[model samples]
Target: MIYKVFYQEAKDSTPRREQTRALYLDIDAQTELEGRIIARQLVEEHTAYNIEFIELLSENHLEYEKTHADFSITEF
Candidate 1:
């Protein structure tokens, strides 16, 4: 299955730190559930760094567009 990971920069106002990246990943996996798990694990591993995960509920064209308008509007 194919998976898309959307990440956003995280800022720690209290600590006065910021990360300079807005991350997005496209991955192919054997299963959707496994893909999500893998994405979760990646976010967990990067917790120490200034990284934040923005979960994608569905990869469906319509749904994905509703969630993110930055991507092309046409069906995927």
Candidate 2:
């Protein structure tokens, strides 16, 4: 499964640290259900922060990538 994670970094209201959060996941999976499960777990794991998730399915390879750019710059 190939997965791409898009996220953003921002300063939280508190002064301790910054936040890097997931916005979406592009995935290559054997089945739609598995992709959904992976996306759900990722969202669950980061629920405490301001993270969001989207899932897309492919069936070619098992690669995972992450990006931290603005959504407006990325072509949907």
Candidate 3:
């Protein structure tokens, strides 16, 4: 299953308060719990702040379509 995790980070000066910047990650896992765990681990390793929210966007099909769009070139 593929999950889209949405997370918000805090500012350097204020760790408690959230900053304007946000991160969106697409993760593959068997379950929602696993996805959340992966998201937490990624945030811990990569970012200084904790994740504010973690959600499952879609199961499998839609995620791929959204991430990889179909494109074509037409000669004029």
Candidate 4:
């Protein structure tokens, strides 16, 4: 499944809504808890951002993407 991992610059202060950043990962996990743990490790290996939250791709995620046209996934 795909996970949207919210994060922000580790060296910067906590950001406001507009300043938040995100990265997408395809995690092969079953539950939210499991996905979260995998998401953290993936982020750590690829970036220096402090994780804010991890969102699994479900019904709500699809709606969010529709509403925010700029939402994207990076293929590595």
Candidate 5:
């Protein structure tokens, strides 16, 4: 299954603050619990920030795509 982990930088009472960021991960797991574990591990190993939320975007999907289009309308 694929999951979108929405995490933000941990708030700190410091002079310099970090901006909020989100990460999208394609997790391969059987259950939600497994997915969360994988996501947490990935973040812990790769990043130095804490996660705020973990959301499931889709299941059995490997890739994500986006498209853009433009249209014109006229009224009299």
Candidate 6:
């Protein structure tokens, strides 16, 4: 399954309306728990980010792909 993670830089406050979107990430994992874990690990290792939420995308993956021109599955 694919999980979409919305996050913001740890040093930054909540984004304003004009922010468009928080830094976006899509991770492929066997389950929701695994997806969350990997996302956290990647963020912790690469940059400081506060995860806003995680959404399961396997159901809406097609729509997501069409909507986000830069969509990709993040590697852990």
By lDDT, who's the top model here? 4
Reference-based TM-score, model 3: 0.52
Q: Can you give the lDDT of residue 57 in candidate 5?
A: 56
Show how many residue pairs clash in every candidate, following the order shown.
Answer: 0, 1, 0, 0, 0, 0
Write candidate 2's Cα lDDT for 36-75 as tens digits: 6776566557554433344452433222233333332121
Q: What is the lDDT of candidate 6?
A: 0.64
Residue by residue across 14-66, what tens digits does model 4's lDDT show?
Answer: 66677788777777788888988988887887777888888887877767775
Tens-place lDDT digits, model 1, residues 1-50: 33344443444433332534333444456776766777656655765434
Candidate lDDT values, in order: 0.47, 0.45, 0.55, 0.77, 0.57, 0.64
Candidate 2 accuracy as TM-score: 0.34
Ranking by lDDT: 4, 6, 5, 3, 1, 2
Cα TM-score per model? 0.38, 0.34, 0.52, 0.73, 0.59, 0.59
Minimal lDDT window, size 10, model 3: 67-76
> Model 4, stretches more than 4 Å misplaced?
63-67
What are the per-residue Cα lDDT tens digits for candidate 3 across 1-76? 4343344464345434334334455666778898779877877776666456665655464556466644121111
Candidate number with greatest TM-score: 4
Q: Which regions in candidate 5 have their CA more than 4 angstroms from the true location?
A: 10-19, 59-76
Better of 1 and 2 by lDDT: 1
Identify the superior model by TM-score, candidate 2 or candidate 5: 5
